[model samples]
Target: MILRRALWEGLLSLVEDAEDVPWILLGDYNAVIDNSEVCGRAADTSASMTEFRDFVTAAGLVHLPFKGCPYTWHNSSEGSRSLWKRLDRVLVNEAWLGAWPQSSYLSALPRTSDHSPLVVLGIVGAQEAKPFRFDNFLARQASFLQSVASVWRHPIHGTLMYGVVCKLKNLKSVFRSKRKEKGDLASNVRQAKEFLATAQALHEQHKEDIFLVLVKCCRMVYCAAVKMENMMLHQRAKLSWLKHGDQSSKVFFRKINSRRARQRVYQIYNSEGECLTEMHKVTDEFISVFQTLLGGVRRRRTIDLSWLRSDANYVLSTGEGECLILPVTEEEIKEAFFDISEESAPGPDGYTSLFYKAAWPVIGRDVCEAVKEFFVSGRLLKQINATTLTLIPKVQMPSQVSDYRPISCCNVIYKAITKVMVKRLQQVLHLIVDQSQNAFVPEIIADNIY
Candidate 1:
């Protein structure tokens, strides 16, 4: 037990000192994760298992999913004395999993030994279809707006949410088409500028109407393309300085490249201390880890609320209570929708606040109706509430999943609804909440200072 603890400590120290690279620590851990991992025995729910669990959690290790036989080790004894346990397996950290998302682990049958030999396979170079993401720069194009209006105006029979989803899907196709038509913006800008310069020179020498008009049109196209490219870089970089006239695409591009490199994960260790490079195995490891985390034992403990009743100062006024549960209104909904920043990132729906603000005349009624329906039914479509969770690294060269903070990007519709509810709550919150707790309450901090 002392030797095992020393080994565990050493492994952790190594991980702490190692560079932020993909790591997999696999082989005979000689420990079963849970009761399911052992057979022909009641299972050891003891201090050893507790220490093993703590080691895994503290080390930020993720167990890889095994294919074929679950039990990798077995005692060669009679039925009564026989024992089987998953002692040999694979484990990896988040950095490794990120590097090889599709890696897989396979447990090969033991030929002569009690332990099974494991093989890790990397991801095959298979092309996957990219998901749809709305480009803010697209909004700058007049034809893009026309295309959106045309598709959105088409009638669809369903719930407000369903109709909105369908219209957005159709608009995706339109945007794809528009993207193809636009070709490459960088190339377009360069070619246009070249043509404009030549045409201007010709017009200056010959004083020809055709050359002058050509120069004017080409110059306008070039400027528009440059502006669109700048907007795209601005959106992608998300730098505060970029918002205020710092329009250096080269600087922004460099920052974007550095960020991507930092985020990319490339290697990991498996059981038996073997390093895995296969993409499939890495992917399997991550899936297994998350499933275990999200589907683990649920222990509910009852908490005593008796102490809260002793505090008489927490009572709310009759008017304040009424305001808390008040029905949402269209005016409040509109205010919430407009309250969101136009530059705020869009959700999975691929519709941004800018799109809604620009095309409010055509889509406002449907959006308003959708929000009202949600309030009335007290339910919303799954897609509307669906959020994309992005991991932001909290430290430089983070090796574990815990080192990154998960931020959920919810749909604009969801944000609008929540914003309105928050505004309504703000009016009554100050009256009910204690003055010491001044997080969302307006002027509470200043009042306390005075």
Candidate 2:
């Protein structure tokens, strides 16, 4: 155990030295992370599990999600004496995930040995361009609101949604120009530091009033540069708050890179099981699967709900149901906006809740009227409700579109509309939900259902 602990520490040191590049550790360590990885009557694995978990966590490695045989090793004993365990697996670092977000492994059946063979499941292709994403730090700028307001002043002759859409569209160019002006944050910090150092050097030699003023001005500029750089890093890294003592910029960049890498769809498998790297072909595969699944023909299977209806004792009254149909109030609209996290992912609009919250006072009337107009007229612009579908790999090596989970990122206004409706729905849920089904009900502990 002592020798193993020492080896873990040694490996940790090595990993830290080359943390910039993609790395993975794969082997049969003859130890399992938990009791689930072991089967049959074996000695207490508590100490071993703790040690292995500690090493993996401290080393900042993650288990590569795999498919195929769960038990990689067999004891090769008869009946009751037979034992199985997953002794072989793969572990990866953030750089590896950043390099191949779709990467996984397969545990093939053992042929000659008791241990199963493992194979890395992934294919690398050319990188694609990323769409524009709003930087959270930009919203904090003093000129941000002014820039937005300047463009928004233009009158767009259309529906309320169209007007808001046009205004947002104009603001995009403004924000882009702002980002270009900001340039590279890291470079800015470097230049600022260089200027400050020169000022300090001259100040030491002269010690005159002019040099003293120059040093202070340079110092202030350097501090501002550092603040902007750190803010940009924090937003990209998606950290809620940064610790004052820890100021590692590389960590933040790595997180942002890893997230971007993971979201890129490099390739997919066709029905014939051939790997495809072409982007258009992959797009067609996704469209075909989703179209068929969502609007496809199905078996004429009818479910028997007569027994359930008869046994059900809970149902909403007319007044209770009327509450749900009541018109959404402005308070509900504001509450929904406040409920969403400022840093949460944005849709095609490239605008997050932060923009809505920060600029509420300026655009509040326009937004409220827009939302209210939708409910009154029963019409909403497609752009306002446009969604961005992000695919997440479900299996070790997702070949087909079905193997990937699709998450839809809807526009904030559209989300806010639904959120207000959900708030109303939540109030009446307890009236209709059975006492036995505890999940999602107010004041009902889900564990009690167990």
Candidate 3:
């Protein structure tokens, strides 16, 4: 028992080595944290469980949520003497959780072994796709709405989604022109400052009304130029915590370069165990691995949910169920867009929530129509369903594809649709979810559960 306690302490010490960086610790510790994890005759393990729980608390780790076989280890004994326990686990610190917020894992039942096999499933990594990054800085400009309005005004003859997609494509050029007109952000800032300085000098030399007015105008231009440049840096850096004007240009540059370096997957081991270092081979490996993983049994049994009604404290009424299925309203769509953070990552369309909000007046009717068509027809345009898979490195020197995390960056339109549906779900959540189930229930927290 003393030696077991030492194991827990040793693991905790290893976590300490990572400091504040994102880190994960996964393996079979031969320990269980809860009594519910055990089945059949077993010796008292409360001491071991407490020590393991303590170690987890000390390290500030959350159990990486997993699906599949719950009891990972079974003592192969039959009938009354059978024993089963979830001995394997994947624990990650808060920093790791923050880094890959939607990350999880999978545990498969053992075919020829005593313990289940674990698979780290952090979104699984991105597929190699053509780059099309829509700069948020472009959306913030004065003529930005005008540029969007110009293309969006012309109606394309096809699916509602097709029209939107085409308009977005055309706007790329409009935006390109706008960006060119605005010129290089760094150069713009420098020139604006120079102009401001010159104006101030001329005003100082001659105390005339015209010179004073010119000086004030130049000062405004300089400030605006600096603000635009800062916005560009902030968007690219993806450092949300960094303040807007904390003299963070150098920091932003460093962060962007670092991210670019980590995203490149130069090598991967294929299904045949052959190592491939070429970029094309690596991309093909990602595609093959994901296809196999996602292709599951098409034949499935229909779940009997009638039993849920009996177990639940309360169930949704007929009216509540009907309301949930009702077609979404334009007001609801607008609300969803407004609810999302403007800085939230853009999908394949390269436009964030801010674009919709700014161009809402001009595009609201068409936007609402495009969203409404989905509910009415029960079909989605392929363009609307398009997603960009982004790969983020999980280790200092990643060797396998699993060493990278997968992040699905869906388009803004798709998110808006989901957001509206989620809002509807929230209305009936309390009625359907039992009070005992605290997590994910709106306004209910699991503070009492320790």
Candidate 4:
């Protein structure tokens, strides 16, 4: 008979849920086989052992076989007063039994203790070791060589450029087979030879300075572009703040009630009017504080933020987190606004106002003129200094003198010449805009400010 009842409160619980995995419960039961299992046993009919058995049964556990020594506990009394007991047992469910039919249980006797050692035996599959490849060992050495070569080269260009050139050359075979002048590969090879010759000439004149200069200029331009992007991000964040900053004020005045509900409705209007006046003062304080922060302005006079938070709703919602929703009291509002005004009181650096300093310069002439016109119309600033400054890297320090390079340097010089020619075109456009600011305002600078 299965006698199921609570034992030790909720101590011995059953496992009702099972995941997709083989499970086995093999451990000592600390129970007896029966009353005959021990001669000097006390209360063999106790409910403790029955409760454990019921838990095992409810959990769908299957008891396994006992091999050599079944008795797990023995009383070591003098002579004929000794008794042996089966205190340990093994239990596993049907899932493990069906999965591994050859698996068996081993129960060994205790040497110096009462509990016995239990072991689960099964015929598990063998796993084979993978074979080593000579190419793998060579691959590691090749990677090490590649890393060392890259480090020695110092700012090495990636092999991807060669791959791109090769793909472009492949187009000669792909689109036009053996054409002479217009063939892609033929033209590319000719251009490559010319580049090599120019590089050789540049090397002969100046060894490394020209290349270093160009690289430094490129990096500087890249950094400037990055800075411009950061400024835009800051502007975006400020705009977003302007849009959502008034939400707290909206939350403040959502609930309103009369000061005295019992008085005649029309006669009690005076006190209600006073309450509303107090509320407006609170709202005004909120706006003044926020606007002052955005304006980056400071005042010598004290400003109270609490005069606006008059309603019980305002007081209750003033607490932190969700739990502190008790309407803010008049004292609380005074304390909060006092702290704000004290912290907000003026200081010296008033000249460093956000209003005066523009974050970036107007790049082109038309943009610059438009900006100047806007400020002039608004009476913000009298004049702005729009000077043409070339954006070059801080490194490289512009050089007027030529240096020696290998005969191969001519190829590099030719490339540099092409770049310089492009720069000259840009300079011409800039000069024309600066000279004829009124005419170029709509077309030139409007196309490119960045």
User: Using TM-score as the measure, which candidate wins?
Assistant: 2
Tens digits of per-residue lDDT for model 2, 117-146? 999978555667766677766888888778
Task: Please give the TM-score that candidate 2 achieves against the real structure.
Answer: 0.68
> On a 0 to 100 scale, what is the lDDT of residue 39 in model 1?
84
Which model, 1 or 2, shows the larger lDDT? 2
**Predicted structure 4: clash tally:** 41
The models' CA-based lDDT, in order, is: 0.74, 0.79, 0.78, 0.36
Better of 1 and 2 by TM-score: 2
Each model's RMSD to truth, in Å?
14.7, 6.4, 13.7, 35.8
Candidate 4 lDDT by residue in tens digits, 280-367: 4534543454445346455555655575445322232322223322232333322222232111111111111121111112112222
What is the C-alpha lDDT profile of model 3 across 258-329, one tens digit per residue? 455345454677767888855678889898777686665667667668887678687778998999988888
> On residues 1-450, what C-alpha lDDT tens digit does candidate 1 reach at each position?
778788789988887676267778988987776777788845766776888888876666666544557789988876877889888878776566657755658788999999999998675577788677677778777675677779888989988878887787888888777767878766777787798888889999999899889888988887887887777777766675566335545555545544554565444444345554566775565556555755656586665557665774676678777877777777888888888886677787767777777667777888888888888888788888788766677864344445556676888889999998888878877766776776558765776675
- Residue 147 lDDT (model 1): 77
Judged by lDDT against the true structure, how good is candidate 2? 0.79
Per-model TM against the reference: 0.65, 0.68, 0.66, 0.24
> What is the clash tally of candidate 1?
31
Best by lDDT: 2
Off by over 4 Å in 2: 64-71, 96-113, 118-122, 176-289, 296-332, 389-408, 420-450
Error at 179, model 3, angstroms: 2.1
C-alpha positional error of residue 155 in candidate 4 after TM-score superposition, expressed in Å: 91
Ranked by lDDT, the better of candidates 2 and 3 is 2
